[model samples]
Structure formats: C-alpha cells, structure tokens
Target chain A: MQASEFSRWTEENAVYAVPKTIIRVGQGERSTAIEGAVTEDFLIRTLKDLIEQGR
Target chain B: MSPLSDRDRQTLREMFRDLKYPVHLQLFVEDGNQGSDNAKVLVREVVRVMPDLLRLDVFERSRDSLLAALYGVWEVPTLILCDQKREDSGIRFIGLPSGYEFAALIEALLDVSQNRIRLSEKSLNFIRNVEDDIILDVFVAPT
Candidate 1:
C-alpha cells in the first residue's frame, strides 16, 4: 500500500523508509519484513531461510 | 492535464517499441479519493503512450466487489498487471505509483509484457520448487 496515503498504516508498520517489504508465506503463517533495497539473491535466500525456519 | 510530460511520453513510447506481447493493466479505484484519482491519471497517461502494447481496465472497488475479490485486491488504487489473456502476473502496485515507484511500475510492465524474470539460477530453482501461496506486501513511499 502507499504508505504516504495512510498515516495510520505507516505509523503502525513503522515504515520510516522507502522499500520496506513484508513477505508472507501460506496464509500469514510466517512473515518477515526487510528494510532497504535488497538484491534478488538476498531476497531468495531470505525466503528459503524463512521457509526452512518454519519447518 | 496529462500526468506525463512530453519527454516522458516519448521515452515510454521508445521503451515499449520492442514489446512483443500485450500487457493488461487492471486498476481498482475508490470513488472521490484523491490518491485513487491520481493513480488513475498516471496509469492512463502511461497507457496512452503505448496503446498497442497495453490494455487498461478501471474498476470501481465498491461497484466491482466480485471482480476485486477475484483479483484479491483489498485496497483502493491497486494496479494489477496481467497478460493479454487476462491472466495475473503476480505483480501489483497498491497505490499511486509516483516518484521512484513509477520506475518500478514501468519495469514491471516491461517484464509482464515479455513474460521475463531476471532471477539468479538458484532463485529460479527455488521459485520452481515452491509449493505454497506466497503474499508479498512491499510498502513504499512515493518518494
């Protein structure tokens, strides 16, 4: 969502920067937030690790 | 007034000149909202530059509840990228894509049009082996 459009959402999520990504797997069972610009490799690794941690 | 400048329009036309497939932009908007209206304007301007490669459909969220639900859109001013056949490409923008986000929107359009994914080999493998429905909410400021 546009953080600028929703003050409440931005405050609740603590979106103090641009490109704050929240990744969720399987109906919100597991989720993680990554701040700043991330590379494709980093994102892929994080996803794999998050899934592994849930196992 | 057009949201895009003449130079920006020319650049977009050039960028999309090599598009091999048509991309559909499905925009879900709320009535009487400034942000939604701005989003509509920007998307319309972008599409106008490359009509041959882009198709746009605007849906009022309140009036098109079923269509919104079908596309899993729960927010106003959300833009979904789809194929020529109206298949979802799993790319979406949940607000007005201004500032830096506009560049991302353009990149997504290009990728969607070509059905291209520039991922690493390992990342590609991970995606291919994925068996779960994933939802990624990338929150961003316009600037």
Candidate 2:
C-alpha cells in the first residue's frame, strides 16, 4: 500500500483487543500501552510498512 | 467464565463485519498468565463468530520460545497480528487487549485483512519518503 493509502485507511478504522477493564499497571499505577487514539496512529503508520515489506 | 457478554459479542461481530482479507491473530502465552486465558477465550469467541475474517494461532512460550522471541516478546500475554504469510504487522499488545483496547484488536485485524491505513497527508508523506529503517513504538500511560 502507498503512504497515503496507509494513512487514510488505518486512521479511518483501527482495531485492537484488551481486557474488560484496564485498572492500573507500571510503577505509578498507570496504563501499560494503553490502546486507543495513540494505537490507531501507531497502526496507521506501522501496518503498511509491515504489510508491504514484511518488516 | 465468559467475559464477553452477548452485547459485546454482537458489537465485535458487527465491528468486524467488513474485513477484506484473512488475518491471523498470533498469541503467545506462558504459565500463570491469567490475562492470556481471558484473552484466549475472547479471541476464540471472536473468531468463532467471524470464522472467515480471523484465525487464532496460539503458542506456549516454553514450547515456541523461538517464534515467540522473534516478535520481541519478553512477557506473557502478548498479542500480534500476522498477515497471510504469518508475518508480524508490527501491531502488538504487551498486556491483555481488553476494555477500551478491545477496539484496537478488532481494527488491527481489519487493517491487515484490508491492507490499509488511514492517516493525514502529512503523516503519509513522512512514511512515503522514509529512506532508512525506522522503528516505531507508541506508548500510552495514564498520567
């Protein structure tokens, strides 16, 4: 997929899985890799590179 | 106990209705990781409902340490999405992807199945002109 395609498709729709509720983790009772908008952005940028080159 | 209630299951079923290609959700679990158990059942139900769009590949860390380590998994209950050839898509979860993160699990599959990403033109440009190897990691912590 091209860069633009990668950007558009992933941002529009991103998927992930997690427990029913994220209580707390880490040193200061924080979320460990909380997945949401940040995750969508990450996936949007990351998927194409993986899908295209298998990297 | 089944964590996913009827409503949530229906929600997931609808969310994953339009996946274009098939996606394999690779799970790596070690002993004493209760999160992996919940995640396993959740994913099982999801794939059970959407048999065409998703598949589950499970590996015990002790049994599949080589493959598990390939994905940089040093902890239990790591979830990664794989393409048709079972290549990692760089979308990974260190802990159980539940609660709000459940959406991410579904979309990771959708993105791979469809082979698409949605980003701003600026982000796309950066991804386009990249000439060197780049490692991308996104972290979220409640502060």
Candidate 3:
C-alpha cells in the first residue's frame, strides 16, 4: 500500500532477474473486454504468487 | 497508474532470482487513447521493480497491423510468454489483470517461465511434441 512499505519489501526478497512485461489496456474500449479498471492490490498479489512459486 | 506496490516488486525480484528462462512482456497500446497513459505508468512501475526479470516493449500497431492480427493481440494489456528457444505458446488474457485475473496473469507468467502448464501429463505430452505454433486465447472478466 504505502510506497515506503512496498519499497522495503522489494529490497529484502528480490532474488533473480527474470524478464517480464506489463501491458496496460484502456477502459471502455470496443476491441477487447478490459471494460473497467484493475486495482493495485490485485496485481501485486497475483505477481507475488507467480514469483513465489518460482522459488 | 502504478500496477505494483513496493512490497509486490520486492517479492517479484526475489522470485525472479530462481528463473531458468527469461520473461518478456510485450505491451500493445493504441495511441491517442486515454487509457494508454495509465498503462504506461503501470508498465514503468513493473519494470522499475524487476528490471532483470521483466522488460516491457510497446508496439503501436497501425489499423492494418492491428486488424491483420499476428499473435491475436486484440487488446492493449495482453501478455505473451516466450521460452528460451524463442518458441511461442500462446497464453492470452482479454482484459487488464486485476482481482482474479491478476492472479491468473501471475500464474500464466509462472507457467510460461517454467515452461510447465498445469494440464495433465497427457495434455502436456500432446503440447510438447506438436511442432506447429500453438495459440491459446483465454477470455475472462475482472471479478
């Protein structure tokens, strides 16, 4: 949540360097189904799980 | 616009330390769109956290490029995983990864990075031996 807390967590647990990309989609567009906004908590949790499993 | 909090970035950096294969994220965006700015911010934030394990590439496709459809990237926030050998096994999401879809995105990334899909052994065998490029399109809502 807070920037400081997030920064501290990142500093301690970072292990290996893996390549990743984040694609941002616009809302209310017609071509695809990204109809609304996505929250930060959701993305962080998802990414954390994905990375943890790697270890 | 920042997609990852500080803690999330740290966790990702730690997880990436064990990665055997490289992860590449290609961001598809349309110019002159309001959402593009937010998308850019998210992309930048992710990169800031795990610079080694993640890289973001932006492609501004023309109407023809977008319509012609190579990789079935119909949306801006679509993520594709490429193995070490430069082979593509299509894993796609139709919306921004938030809520349940956020977890899905991470799972997809792990699957791609590890080159291990959760499919049964039979399905895994089927996918491994196949020579042709396999394109998979998954559609989901942010619940």
Candidate 4:
C-alpha cells in the first residue's frame, strides 16, 4: 500500500480509527502480527501500502 | 470442601509458585445467583495452580459497598486484572473467562505482570505512535 491511499481512506472514515503501530510478525510463508493504537494517519498510510502491495 | 480434586489442586499450587508478580482473583457472588457456586469452584482451582499470582477474594455485597464500586462490579464473577505495582487498568471480565476467552485472560494477565505485549516490529510502530486513549472491549463466551 502506498502512503497516499492510506491517508485518504483514514481521513474519509470516522468510525474506523487508524492504528498507531502495525507490526507484521513472523517470517517467510506463515508470517502474522497484530495492529495496535489506530490513529488517522497510520490507517491511511497502512491502507496505501496494502493497496500498493496488492494485498 | 474444596471443589478441585487433590491432584489438580497440587498442580495449580506448583504453577503459581513460579510467578514473578502477585495475582488476585476477586470473585463477586450475589445471593442466589445461578453460577455462584461454579465461580467459587473455579477460583479455588485457579488459586491452587498459581497461588503466587492468584488470590481468591470473595465479596458478599453486604461486606462492603465501596469495594464493589471500586471494581465496577455490578454482576457476579467479575475478574479485574491489576499490574505488579497494584495499579488497576480498568480491564474487567463480566462473566466466566473460559473457552477461547480464557486464552485472552491468560495473555492479559501476562501482559499486566510483565508490562509488555509481544508484537511484531510493524505492529509495534503503530502502537507506539498512538496518543489517543483506545479502549478495546473484546467479548467472548465461556463455552
């Protein structure tokens, strides 16, 4: 996800708060982690990066 | 008579001995409540395992009003997790912490005792930047 997409989505949604930290734990094929403290900016950035990665 | 069998009680007693911080399990029972007996039994079983971090404090309502209000316990079998410093973070369980929720209860207890939640780097980054007060209320069933 690119930075811009992350910003736009978070700004538009009021109910969904962006996470302060987005940790992708684990490694290789079976990696998993949890997101915490969602703030406005973090949500936008995360979404953008996700979209860019096509995830 | 204790609800737990002799074997189970012994195992619990050993588990609690290894804890680094003290734990308290305050069980609030209302007269004639359906699960009061069950709750008491569960507390006894838990105390037997982690006696160091686990304590069973029973409140009969008539004993003290201030204690109930302090814990915000309106119902029976409420579990409040406190840190090592004796600070209450306001994390509460309204019903029995069994089943999938039991895992959550264990994790929360560990977090309070250790003062840390193991997360990935990316997740940690997001969490560290959060300035706002975030209230996470997770609901689950005992079964």
Candidate 5:
C-alpha cells in the first residue's frame, strides 16, 4: 500500500518513511511505532514490552 | 490487457506452487474510487494466477455494510487476507499493493496460504499467549 493513497492515515500516523510500522494494541487507543525495518528479535521484544506495559 | 507481464505471472505461479492450503482474499471497494479500482484490478490479476491456492471475493462497501463492519474494514480498497477457514490473518493492504508493497503482498499471501509465520518459537509462544488484540499497521510507500 502506498502512503500517498492514504493521505489522512499518513498524516495522522506521521508516516514520513518507507517502512513505518505501528504496533497498535487493542482498539488502537494505545500504540507504538518504528520508523524503519527491524529485526525479528527487536520487534518481538518491542511487542513484549508493550504487552507488559499495557498489562 | 493485463497489468502484470507474462513473466510476472509465471514467477507467481512458481512461487505459489508451495501453497498447500487455501488463502481467501476479501476486498472491499467503493464505486468511483480510483484507488479502489486499481486495487480491484491488481488483486484480481494476482488471484487469477493462483486460482488453486487463492480465493478472492470482491464486495461493495456500501452494499455489504454489515460484512464490512464485521471484518473491521472501514476504508475503500482494503484487502484482507485470510486463512483456509476464512479467518482473518490480521494482514491487510489498505491500498493498491504496488512497487515494493507488491512484493510484500505476495509474501503475505504465501505466508497465509502455508499457515506459516516466520517468527522464532519463543516469539510465537509469546504471541500465542497474549490475550489482547494486537494489530500491526505497516505504513509503506511505493518506492
């Protein structure tokens, strides 16, 4: 999906990069994001941290 | 005329050869939306190449309001990939999957068709144990 086509989403999410990844927890009320490509370990760790924080 | 080249179709056929299960693609579209139209064409062409492995169902957003809401689809040109049981895999491409995003779409289809998630055992375990809903919205550009 191209960010240009989703202008509103890009603007709201601040998607200024190629691979901006948003980790949205639950109904998108709480979330975290990464601006670039990340390793599986890093992503998993981030997810774990977010899960812990939410808990 | 097809948007994909003959070579592209051949490559997709080869890539889809390993698909052992069914992948259902639910595409939500609205009339007169250029992005929606493009997504419809691209998705149909991609699924055409792998009919044995892929199932595509196109829907009008306004006409299928209940289904759209059920699937949590609130946008035009939202392509949702599902497993054999028609269960959503949480993989969605919100616009036409073009350029680099096209490759990601192919990979996602393959993954869903094969029921394969390329995460480590520990990561998989953690995900499986998590009770809360997790959504990964990957924002990408054509370049």
Candidate 6:
C-alpha cells in the first residue's frame, strides 16, 4: 500500500497492528522447520508460547 | 543518503497535519551495518516531515542494550512506533522500511498516534479482565 493510500488493516476507531511475516525467503520453499530462521514454524511456536502462557 | 525527495516531503507534511497526537519513532540502530545505516537516514527524513507530531530517537545497543532488550529488539534497524509517552505499541518494522514498507511505517505513525487497538468484544473482554504480558513479533522483508 502507498503511504498516500488508506490502510486496509486500519479502522477509524481501532488499529490492528499485528506482526506480519514473509512467506518465502528465497526461490525455493525450504523453511527452517525444526530450528529457527524467522519462518512460519517459528512464528507458530511463538504463538503457541502465548497460548501456553494463557493456560 | 537523503531518502526522501522534496516533493515527497511536502506531500508527507500535508498528510501529517491530520495526526491527532504525537508519535515517537524509536530507532534501534547498529553501528556498522549497511541496512541500518540506510534505515537511519530514511527514518530521519520521515521524522523531519512531521516534527510536531513525530520525534526521532536512535539508540545503539553498545551503550543502550537495556532499552533494546526491554523492547525485545535483537536486530539492527528495528524501527518501533511509540505513542506520545514513548510506550511501545507492539507495532514495529524489523528492517529498513524502504519501498513498500515505507507505507507501513507511515500508516504505523498514524496508528501509534492514536495509541489504540480495536478488538472484537470477545477479545477485548478477555484482555480487559485477563492479566498477562503479551509479546508479538511480526516479521517482514523489503524487496
């Protein structure tokens, strides 16, 4: 989105500032599933941590 | 390098007039990194467009690691959008917000100025009554 354009994720009364992650790093889709390299798996684990803390 | 053109600056100044509150741009920079260096310049230029509504603060971990750690920042060129009191809004750009990310940064500035998050009633009720520290890490890249 352009800075001049309105934000789709933003609302008049509320701002949804959720963290966003890139899907693909390079050409092929070889994410660091087991370890951590700022991929989808890592993000899920981070979300899981939040859920775990809630429990 | 000056990242913003005079025309862009002018346009941004007009856009910033709509800011209802001040938004602080807290930049965590690394000394020797190329991307960090570029991001610093970019952030400075943007902050200049709205001096009344935005302030720029740059920090180095070598001297201010505690502040960075407090924000959960472990990377160079982490641009955090803070509210009037300089509170973290959990809205951050982890790299140089050049290109498309620049729009995100500008929007973030507006969002932070408001210092509000609109949630569903269910979620808002949960957060309003529940007591727990929340940590969210959003990852993005520049192309």
- Tens-place lDDT digits, model 3, residues B34-141: 455555666567556656666666666455374328777765545555555545656654434455656666666667777876556754564465443222112232
**Per-model DockQ:** 0.60, 0.04, 0.02, 0.04, 0.60, 0.10
**What is the C-alpha local distance difference test score of each model?**
0.87, 0.67, 0.52, 0.57, 0.87, 0.68
Candidate 3, residue B17: lDDT:
64
Q: Model 3 residue A13 lDDT? A: 33
Candidate 2 residue B128 Cα shift, in angstroms, is 6.2
Task: For candidate 2, write residues A1-55 as lDDT tens digits.
Answer: 1226434634433324321112122222222233445554654444444434532
Candidate 4 lDDT, B1-143, residue by residue in tens: 65557885675455434466766656677666656666666666666567667666787754656888887777666767766666774567666665555556666666666666555677668667654333332122234
Please provide TM-scores computed only on chain A for all of the candidate models, following their numbering: 0.70, 0.25, 0.33, 0.35, 0.76, 0.33
Give the Cα-based TM-score of candidate 2 against the true structure: 0.64
Best by TM-score: 5
Alpha carbon deviation, residue B10, candidate 4 (Å): 8.5
For candidate 5, list the clashing residue pairs, or say none.
none
- Candidate 6: segments with Cα more than 4 A from true spot: A1-55, B129-143
Displacement of residue A15 (Cα, Å) in model 2 is 26
Q: Where does the lowest 10-residue lDDT sum fall in candidate 4 chain A?
A: A24-33
Q: How much RMSD separates candidate 1 from the native structure?
A: 2.9
Which segments of candidate 5 are over 4 A away from where they belong? A1-37, B135-143
**Superior candidate under DockQ, 1 versus 5:** 1
* lDDT digits (tens) for residues B44-112 of candidate 2: 887887887688988898899898778888876888898877777878866777776777777778888
Pairs in steric clash, model 6: none
lDDT of 6 at B59: 94
TM-score list, all predictions: 0.81, 0.64, 0.55, 0.53, 0.82, 0.66
Residue range B2-49, candidate 5, lDDT tens digits: 779999999999998988899999999999999898888989999999
Q: Mind giving the per-residue lDDT tens digits that candidate 6 earns over B18-94?
A: 78898888899888888788888898889878788889999986678999889989877788888888777878887
TM-score of 4: 0.53
- List RMSD in Å for every model shown: 2.9, 12.3, 15.5, 12.4, 2.9, 11.0
